[model samples]
Target chain A: MKSAKAKAHTNIALIKYWGKKDPKLFLPMNSSLSLTLDAFYTETEVILDGNLEMDQFILNDEIQGEAETTKISNFLNLFRQETGILTPAKVTSQNFVPTAAGLASSASAFAALGAAMNEVSGMKADPTTLSTFVRRGSGSATRSVFGGFVEWQMGTCNEDSHAIQIDDASWDIAMVTVAVNTGKKTISSRQGMQLTVDTSPFYASWVETAATDLVDIKQAIRNQDFQQLGEITESNGMKMHGTMLGARPPFTYMEPTTIDVLAAVRQLRQQGFEAYYTMDAGPNVKVLCHLSDSEKIQMKLKEAFPNNPVIISKVGGGIELLS
Target chain B: MKSAKAKAHTNIALIKYWGKKDPKLFLPMNSSLSLTLDAFYTETEVILDGNLEMDQFILNDEIQGEAETTKISNFLNLFRQETGILTPAKVTSQNFVPTAAGLASSASAFAALGAAMNEVSGMKADPTTLSTFVRRGSGSATRSVFGGFVEWQMGTCNEDSHAIQIDDASWDIAMVTVAVNTGKKTISSRQGMQLTVDTSPFYASWVETAATDLVDIKQAIRNQDFQQLGEITESNGMKMHGTMLGARPPFTYMEPTTIDVLAAVRQLRQQGFEAYYTMDAGPNVKVLCHLSDSEKIQMKLKEAFPNNPVIISKVGGGIELLS
Candidate 1:
């Protein structure tokens, strides 16, 4: 059996993609688009052999437990049944990027693993087919297959629903991530978004509005309209979060210091700086500003929050196959 | 001069009443409505004797500072000037309600003082005039003059912006307050609401959508539909807070325990309890359920959170003049 390994990095959604329509099928409750960043990525390798007693797993250089192995095995078992490999198999994964730091690492990891597994298995399937298998593993992972500004088209089923690239962010609109305290939330994004979808009256509004906002924002990015892009991104993110606030028990990723950072950003805007901020499932803020203004804004932010290190990177390249 | 005193409790809109076409005239950005609680009420006494030295204020049995006193004294001074009073007046305010606890205490305090001042000056103006005067002090307080469920008409000018009682709490809904750790917020409602109005994009959405919710909620209360009333109140309040979340600096009144209470309430609903919650400027959670289920829900809540004591009260009566 020939083994193949492929590594990919997942992107964080500036507008935020939340709520799965079907948890089983990984169909999203709303269509979401995100920018694939180059700074953080994930890598996974897949080996196909019939001699394995049972499916073995390794995540981040460590063997996986039953919980981590189920997603991979289930997808593999389904894929094997579709192909003719009825015998048992082994799957191993290694996530190279930051683990569980509120940035999406698993999505890329699973997407790469799915692609590699398909490659080694010689399944004669396309990226979308691999994406469907990947979606079952993790919903947002399906989007990691494409690069640039990708929109996870919420399909009715595995075949129709997958991610598509909207625009290459390589030209402008840098996503500046300010590194704050890194601690995983007690409630996972899956649990939180599910609770909100089940309980919040505001959830439907977010679902309805996100489609329009995503389309408008993509257009703004294409036009290089910084103000429109900034405004739309901020509003869409806030709408996604508003559902969480209205959830059965409201929860937020906002830390006390997060407000201070926000205040500094607003102060910068008041001082004639054209910077806008969008935050995801964490306390740290991501500012969407022009590439030219990034340095000045980063300097101002550093001065305001000396403790937190700010990293500035422009639109990243698409998923690259590493040797 | 006939030294008469009349007591009035102000109304605080959970939906928020901010912005004014005419600040001096007290016109609001939107029409707001609220319910008056018997547990919290304010009493004010005013004397229009011509021998006083400027406008003096006695708040909570203590003489207020010139600056602190000026908020109320200026309104009184304006009224006195209009009524052709030659001497400076003295206004005494006794807040017989919760203070600095995000309980709309300021609204009740100012409304009561405005009513008393009007009465002492022998101005037999109707509720409309009284509300306008009270609104000249604080926007929401204008709605408190009318008992039961009052609506502050966001008229273009002083002539139209006044509070009117929409419905008496002749229904089965109960307001249960759960006290969390009480401390003054870094931002006061006056400052916070102003910030939200100036900076929040969602502010317009709140202003546009909340009025319809308020009107529908009043009808739902009149129809004695607990479910509709609870749902509307919760949605309206959430929409109001949504604006604050989108405020440039993004401020929230939610604590972790506040979220816990909300979750517990939802859990109760899932457990076959008919309960929903609404929150205001404070971290406390106020559950709106049927009067019959109040004790059962409160007991369950107490069991769930031993530290937080839930205060359950039936539909409270309007303000009564205590001589």
Candidate 2:
């Protein structure tokens, strides 16, 4: 079978996706908006080979163990069922972003894998169909199928639930990522989300508030109101983390450095710069700002966190076939 | 001019009071529940001395500066207005707890001062009247007016809002205070609460959810259900902090060590102990547990943070005249 390689960039949720309504189908409890970024991405090559006894998976040139390989194999089974390809696949993937550190690595990873599979299987599916295929691998992956600002609609079922692009983000907006800890988090996002859903008393409220935030943010983007967009993004993220704290055996992904970065962002805004911050289920903080203020924000974050890594990323495109 | 001394113990809120509806009256946006602890207490003496030129204030044997002296003097003015005593008083106070480190030192401080003023001025106010009096000095102090478990109702006006005893806490409940940082927090609780109220988009939801948590926790206390009480207490504290995180230019009182202590508390609960943690606007954590499990939880926390001070405290009494 012909081999195909594809690339997909990571996306940071402005309106966060924290809980699941249907875990088996990977359906979110509320719609989420995200910005696909250019700085970090993943590339995966897939080829179906009848000679292979079983599926082989390599990540960043390193062979994955049973657990990682099994996850990929099961994910690929979805594609196999659709295209009627029974041959075991050899998959080699490389991630430029940090994994399991709230950087949305799985988003790019699965989106690329899905795109590569679509090509190798000769499916020629549209972006919407590709989003559904990618989402089965990771919920956030559905948004990575489109460029700029995308929203993943939390439809009642699998078929109706998919991502739609809100804006191309060709405006003056950009993001600066402060990597407090690029290493893997002790608790995975999946585990943390599940814990919050099962134990947090405020879980239902979080879903309701997130839905409201999604609507507000979409309107803000349509109106090109940066302030409203930033405000909703910051509030939505806090609500998500709040649910985690209220969860049974409460947990927090924020470290002291994370707070420091956020404080710096606030200070910048106080100093007449329009900047706001949002954090996911890890220690890193991502600041949403105008493209003009990106360098200034990056410098300020670097000065505050001299030891940590700080990177600036522009809005990125959707999944692409890399021949 | 009869001088009187009174003692009141510190109370840590399980359901937090973060915002103010009437800032001048010190009325909270939501009712809060707290447990008065035996470990930390404040002693204050008040005398309506006609010989004094102005109100004098001393804390822990140290003559307080203008700001602190003024605060005590202003609080004393309320007492003077009620009892028709225009004489400038001499106020001396001592705190056995760590001040401003999220140990609820102000709770005990104002409660003791209220009791002393009541005695010296001869107001003959009961506990409910005394609660309203203490609330003017500090909101949490309203709860400190009573021993055992107390709830500060978020009344519509100054007269109606006051704390009442929820339960005697005569059961197996106890608390272990982990002094993660004994130093004063840079952001005072008053300042922090105002910032959150003004800036956080989640502030309204926090108030609503806290009201629900208050009802649930009070019911749990009535049923003498340690598990339910502990669960609601932990969730309530997290929700309060989550609001702060959503604040514009978001702020968090949680340090790295604070998260460490919380993780330890969760581990303890997982190991069959019913330990739960609650925090205010400071980095320190107070763990609520059964009297039987208190020692074990303290030992475990001590093992985790060898440098920090861990003190166990049981149910304490209401304000009492010491002289």
Q: How high is each candidate's TM-score?
A: 0.70, 0.87
DockQ of each: 0.17, 0.38
Which tens-of-lDDT digit does each residue in A1-323 have in candidate 1? Answer: 56777776677786677888888787888778887766666766666667876777887668888887776788777677777765455656666555665666678877777777777677857765666777777777777877778888787876888777888776656767776656776678889889878876566667776777888888887897878877787777766666666664556666656657766776778898778877777777788777788898888888878888687766665444453
lDDT of each residue in A261-294, candidate 2, tens digit only: 7778878989988888898889999999999889
DockQ-based class of model 2: acceptable
Off by over 4 Å in 1: A9-11, A18-106, A121-139, A142-239, A246-323, B10-22, B292-310
Q: Candidates' interface RMSDs, in order?
A: 5.0, 3.0
What digit string (tens of lDDT, one per residue) describes model 1 on residues B193-280? Answer: 7887787656665677677777787788678777777777777776666667766555677665776787788788899877877777
Worst 10 contiguous positions by lDDT, candidate 2 chain B: B242-251
